[model samples]
Target: MTKVLVLYYSSYGHIERLAHAVADGVRQSGASAVIKQVPELVPETVARKAGYKLNQNADVATVAELPDYDAIVIGTPTRFGNMAAQMKNFLDQCGGLWFEDRLVGKVGSVFTSTGSQHGGQESTLLSTHTVLLHLGMVVVGLPYSFKGQLRMDAITGGSPYGASTLADDGNGGDRQPSDNELEGARFQGRHVAQVAAALASANIGATL
Candidate 1:
């Protein structure tokens, strides 16, 4: 079976909600989706004081398991125009996998949440893509086929880069991902999973 990993780091649950939506899309395409979170780097007392979503249901993911999935959908809240340090740290530990080229040819996708409409959403997605490319993965983004990104009537977060959402006021704000944003995430998930299933079923790299 085609397997996908929806890996994310959410300080206050905004990206967590989007991650589940992405997983739902993966399941829509008959692929198994496992959602996991990166380890929190903040001290436990500081995290609690900041009201981080410490009780997130997803387990912390390990670098060793990332290669097991046919596709990986990454999510993060933009931090100064890039992925959060927690997620970046997690990926940084995958040098062993990169050295082995273990993730070569796997599908990779990314999503993000920002505190404002212009708060580095695209940059975050693009920068993350750089890592995926370095790992020799085939990258996928939320293409125009997902029309939710085209809606202009509301203040929403989404782009050709990937599925995204605005995180309300700031890191700890209460605003959740809007319906259009979630739909876009689901669309991205389905697209990535479909592509991975096709590649896996064909066993296309057998030439090696």
Candidate 2:
């Protein structure tokens, strides 16, 4: 069976919710979804510097284990118009995979959550895709043809670039994803999985 990796870093659990939705979509497309969370960072000092936190349970796998998946879906919380440092650090460690071309031709997609509607979701998604491109992965995006694009009244997650979410405030009353946002994420996941499967099949045909 084809496997798609749903890797993400969530500080407030919003992005994690999106990852789950994406996984659901992948499973609906007949692909196995492997969910992985990046390890948090630990600060050297008690002052809590720029990017540091403790990750209690981190995955202990190398890039060599990454290529086993047919596709990758990454999620992150937007940090100052970019992905969180923890996610970027994890991707940076995949240099070995980049060198070996392990990710070449594999389909890749990105998802993000932001504190506000204008909070750099697109930039965060594009930033993650930059690394995927360097690794020669085929990038995937949500198509305008998806019905959610037309029917949603207040869409906080649908983007032509990838999936996204506008997180709720500190009051704990605004974190829930709207129906449109959820539908968009599901569509994004299904679209990426279908594309990855088709590409894998095409590559197999070419090999024959």
Candidate 3:
């Protein structure tokens, strides 16, 4: 079975929720999905003082294990229109894999959450895609086929770049992903899995 990894760095639970939706979408394609998180860089003492969600139970992703997957979908909260430092830190550790060309031909995709409607969701996704390209990975993205992407009547977060969510609730509520955002994540996951499976099959064919 094609193995896809849904890796993310979620300070709160917003990205975590979206990561689960993406994993669910990958499973819908009969692929094996592993959902994990980037290691926290913040000091434990400081994290507790700031009330960061340190209790997240997801397994931590290691650079050595990245080459084991056929596809990788990464999620992160936007930090100044880019991925959070924690996620970037994790990817920075994978230079060994890039040097070995271990991730070449693997499928890669990105998802992100922003604090507001125009909070650089697309920019975050694009930035992540740049790293994937540098690793020689095949990048996948959400197509216009996902009808949820075209919803302008109601506020939603999704674009051709990838799945996204608005972390801020309009009514001064806590940060969380909306239902539409989760659906967008699922669509991205399913699409990436499908593409990865095809690529895996093609690779096997070439070897035969």
Candidate 4:
């Protein structure tokens, strides 16, 4: 079966929900979805006040193992209009994969959650795509053809860049994704899965 990796980092519960929606879409498209979460960075306040550990395991898979997936979908919370440091740190270790072209021709997509509407969702998505391009992966985005586009709120989630969710950060509760945002994420997953499956089949044909 075609396998799609849904890797993400979530501090709160919002981005996690979006990851699940994306995985559901991939599964609906008849591909296997593997969800993995990056290790979190314990804040200094938490370490001092809550007695939390500052650093933890760093033994996550290296980029050489990325080829195990037919496609990859990544999710992150927008951090100053860019991917979080942990995710970037992980991607930076993919230099070997870039040099070997292991990710070439594989499908890739990005999703993000933000504290509010207009809170740099597009920027985060674009930043994530930069690493994918360097790895020679085929980038995918949501098309307006999907029915989810019509129902999204003007102020909340769903974008042509990729799937997005507007999360409430206690300043307001109204910015969270609507049902349409959830559906849009699912659509993106299925779209990438279909594209990856087609490419994998073509590769098989060439080998045969």
- Considering every candidate listed, which one attains the maximal lDDT? 1
Model 3: per-residue Cα lDDT over 145-194, one tens digit each:
99999998888899999999887886656767778779889988999999
Error (Å) of candidate 2 at residue 11 is 0.4
lDDT of model 4 at position 14: 70
Task: Write down the worst ten-residue block by lDDT for model 1.
Answer: 199-208
**Model 1, position 128: C-alpha lDDT score:** 99
Could you give candidate 4's per-residue lDDT for residues 56-136 as a string of tens digits?
322344455688998989888899999988788788888888886778888889999888778899999998999888888
Q: In model 2, where do residues sit more than 4 Å from their true spots?
A: 42-62, 150-152, 169-174, 204-208
The top-ranked prediction according to TM-score is: 1
**Global lDDT of each candidate:** 0.93, 0.78, 0.90, 0.80
Please, what are the lDDT tens digits per residue for candidate 1 over residues 51-140? 888999999999999988999999999999999999999999999999988999999999999989999999999999999999999999
Q: Which pairs of residues clash in candidate 4, taking residues 3 or more apart in a chain or in different chains?
A: none
Could you report the Cα RMSD, in angstroms, for every candidate shown?
1.7, 3.6, 1.9, 4.0
Question: On a 0 to 100 scale, what is the lDDT of residue 35 in model 1?
Answer: 99
Candidate 1, after superposition: displacement of residue 35 in Å? 0.5
Per-model TM against the reference:
0.96, 0.85, 0.95, 0.85
